[model samples]
Target: MELRDLDLNLLLVLAELVREKSVSKAAENLGMSQPGMSNALNRLRALLGDDLLLRTGRGMQPTPYAERLAEPLNEALRLIHGVVNLEMDFDPARSNRSFTIAMTDIGEIDFLANLMRALERVAPDVSISTVRKGESNLKDELETGAVDLAIGWLPDLNAGMFQRRLTASQYVCAFRKGHALDKGSITLEEFARADHLVVLAPHTGHMMIEHDLGRLGVRRNVKLRIPHFAAVGHILSETDMIAALPGRLVNHSIVPFNLAWAPLPIKLDPIPLNVFWSAKYHRDPANQWLRAMMFDTFSEGAPHVSPDQAVPLP
Candidate 1:
């Protein structure tokens, strides 16, 4: 028979009948009456010029033609399914879109200033909402589109994740000027003795440093635990409590507040921060544009650079 004489739905019935080996069971699987299945089977057999299945004492057995048709027919059905389900490609220059970003304190430390400057120069009307996505929740949050993009240190875990590098972040010490330790390089004893403002959110890992120090038998006195990095900076400017912050924020503090960043008394390894969006948003146009901006914002140095180091916008 020509292709138009056969229906694809009959292929589904043929496949299921071959699998189930019983007319009644195939009908049950297809939600059709047994007589209805027999009638469709008769029509399919007439179209193919073959007794596709034979009633045997054991049950129904496929004829040679049916066996030969089964594999290619299933393959063709899968191909059609995949083609019909394909996602459309995205375009950014012509689309006006909003994006929600999940960023850690360090993401703000590393990228926010330049992001604002870049927005001023480019897509100022594109609204960006920054939300706190605790490190623990990043993977599921990204996959579900609870947040479109996340920027921070790549978690030590979740290698299955998808990411792009934003920048490297170095840790530094932040204390108000004229504090008791400002006379010279801070001694380890002075650092451990000073009261520290620690951030205890699951998103912040400052406790690890403290825990490592405790292992060394030289723990700093944690004077308080606050929720956000912005809060930590504000308190450091107004009080004697010192904070260990990312280099970008400390550098920003140099101009905006009378703050000094001496080397950390105990060396902390620099964290490599990245932009991670799930494969779910990998095809979304707005997510792509923001990711491009995130990389560009980092590659073009942060606003913390001296005027001579910055490229003047046209």
Candidate 2:
């Protein structure tokens, strides 16, 4: 079928059908007549040439074709809705839109708290929700306008995407206040000797600590692995297991939690984090306002989205 002949509205019906698993339920969910949902489904089936759903043991199971199309198509529809709605400019004091962000869990501990505080004091009407950075690539998310910004030390992205450096985070080792490793400062040998708990991103191949270690040709004893960076503080509080964390987390978290932090003898490069988005939205008024708010919220160093963020490249 030619582009103009295809009804894009069918995707909404198909997505709802896939989610609700019954034509009647989908119709109810969308507040439409049952026959309307069926008609939309019929049109989708004709265009795609697939029995998009099958009445099986329990309910509708997607055909291979529909199953494959479901996620991307749903995402596309969501993006379209988001972009259309975003045409209205944001007023920091009056607008109540919640900006969705994707970042590492450590960000919740490191950045989220202060950012929320700043927003509460200034942009009280705004809200923020965070989704953990997982297998879903931020490049795709940013390009599709599905996410406003990605915040972290992502080394790989297209060269032309718009980005701004927030801050470079130093590394520190954390332990219970009186834990043996907390005595003074730690040498590389002592740090290497201690059993380590490395917090890794659950689904992605983005292990910053390990990658940094590999560059130095130095290896350490990693005993436990976790999927979330926010968990490290609790782990350090509860166990003797040593973990290297962003110095900001170490600093703000230590005294209250009865934890102590020491300089790691290893020279892991300070992590330079960026607030990045696609160039397509860079000039859009809403995007421009959001980018400025994010920068003002996180601004510490210079304002350049430098191609050379490397004080020393990781």
Candidate 3:
């Protein structure tokens, strides 16, 4: 018989029949009817040109060919099963697996230090690596397991992905601690008058803040145009330049940088920061552990929706 004509399920039935050596016993063990098992035995005999098992004085005995095939068939099935299933347990303390996360510079500043500290305590042997966010091939990377997780404002990562909201964030004007704006409420006119430090972080939902400002016709004397949020805290602390930053970032920087922040005069929508993972790895033990760790570390009191409750984008 040609390989294409072979049914994998038939092989399973043949193996069970050969081992049990009784049609009724094999059918009962395999959850099949007696007639079905008998038909399968007939088909197996015709396919292999061997009786395989024959009724003898003791009940059933295998042909010499059947004896040779039995051990090899069981071994092949065992090997195939080993390849298909992953090790179910992921012991963080013992595992040396390295996980990679994709995020922006701001995410690195906000998450990395705390994440590393947590890792040090529980998963000393495990390591972490990070890749820059907004890569054009990021979707492919996540789907193919090149990146284990992604965090931050990833609006474009819809469909075939799962996201858990981390926090509700909004823009706030941040400046040095003793800056005039720190003492009182900020007005749109005063916000426009100050020399601004604008961050041009591409491929993030943060760009919407600039769009809203433009739509409102609020003008700023942009003194510096930077590409990342990592330097914003330092620059704002040393110079008179004030910048609009996510409230979480400003809060994170305030004590260290001696910076102060107030609500922006312009009304803006709250941006939801989230932790995202590929739907492909949603059930993976290691990936599930990482997702739980991130949620515990950064959810900031937000409600968590279960994977079953939270639907993946189409």
Candidate 4:
């Protein structure tokens, strides 16, 4: 079938149908009746000479052909939509749009509170839903719009994916305020000898602290390993185990917990925290607005360690 003979509307229905996997849900999403959606599906199948979707016991499942079409179709539609709205202005105050973001637990500790506070005054109607970074397939998730933005260190991100660096985060050692090692500065021997509390999150693992130490042929005595950052403050407040975490997270905890932090004795390059989005949404007005809001909120008064203070690994 020629492109001119095809009904462009059918493609939209097909995209939604494949995404929702249920005709009724797709129809609701598209603001159309179920019968209309079914008719559109039929037209798409006839024009493409394939049964794009199959009804399984679970729900509507996309055929091999539909699966192949899903990514390019979504990309094409996003480009068309973005071009049409290139000049549009997004008014966050009046719009009640919800955005999905993927970030690590430490990211929530460093960014979420400040971001929410900033949004309260300007974009009261906007809502944010956050998902934990998965062990893999983050790029695919961003491409498919399962996540609107991904924030944190994603070292393996594809070259084609678009990203903007938000800040440079260095590690700091946190301990209870009066701990023995809570001095003006720590020595590499003191840091290596101290018992440590490490976060071994499933998604991002141990934050590469061990690897960084390995490069210097030194390893900390990790006594406890937890999956999340939320428990770090309480654990460190009560125990002598020192935890090395992002400087921003450590700074955020200082007011609430009896936590004292100093620069890590061993040198490790600062990790670049970035916000990643698909090129498909690069020109989307609403997405652009949210990205800018994220950057502005996170970058304002963000703490940084001076270059002169950085100590090289012994």
Q: How well does candidate 4 score on lDDT at residue 149?
A: 93
Steric clash pairs (candidate 3): none
Model 2, 11-129: lDDT tens digits are 78899988888999999999989999888888888888999999999778888888888899889988999988766565778878778787776667667776888889778988888
Q: List the global CA lDDT of all models.
A: 0.72, 0.75, 0.82, 0.83
Best by lDDT: 4
Better of 1 and 4 by lDDT: 4
lDDT of 4 by residue, 70-168 (tens): 999999999989987668778998989899999887788878887899889899999999998663677888888878999877777647679998887
Better of 3 and 4 by lDDT: 4
Which 10-residue window of candidate 1 scores lowest in summed lDDT? 305-314
Over the stretch 1-314, how does candidate 1's per-residue lDDT look in tens digits? 66776787998888887777788999999999999999989988888889999988987999989999889888887888889787665444444556778876656665777887887677766667788866667677888887888776547424656787666665666788888877636767777789998776564444555554566666678889887676766688788987766677677666567887666666555556677878867876667777888877775332232223222221
Question: Candidate 1, clashing residue pairs?
Answer: none
Model 3, which residues run further than 4 Å from truth?
12-83, 143-145, 279-284, 299-314
Best candidate, TM-score-wise?
3
RMSD of 1: 11.8
TM-score of 4: 0.70
**Candidate 2 accuracy as lDDT:** 0.75
* Every model: Cα RMSD to truth: 11.8, 18.1, 6.7, 15.7
Clashing pairs in 2: none
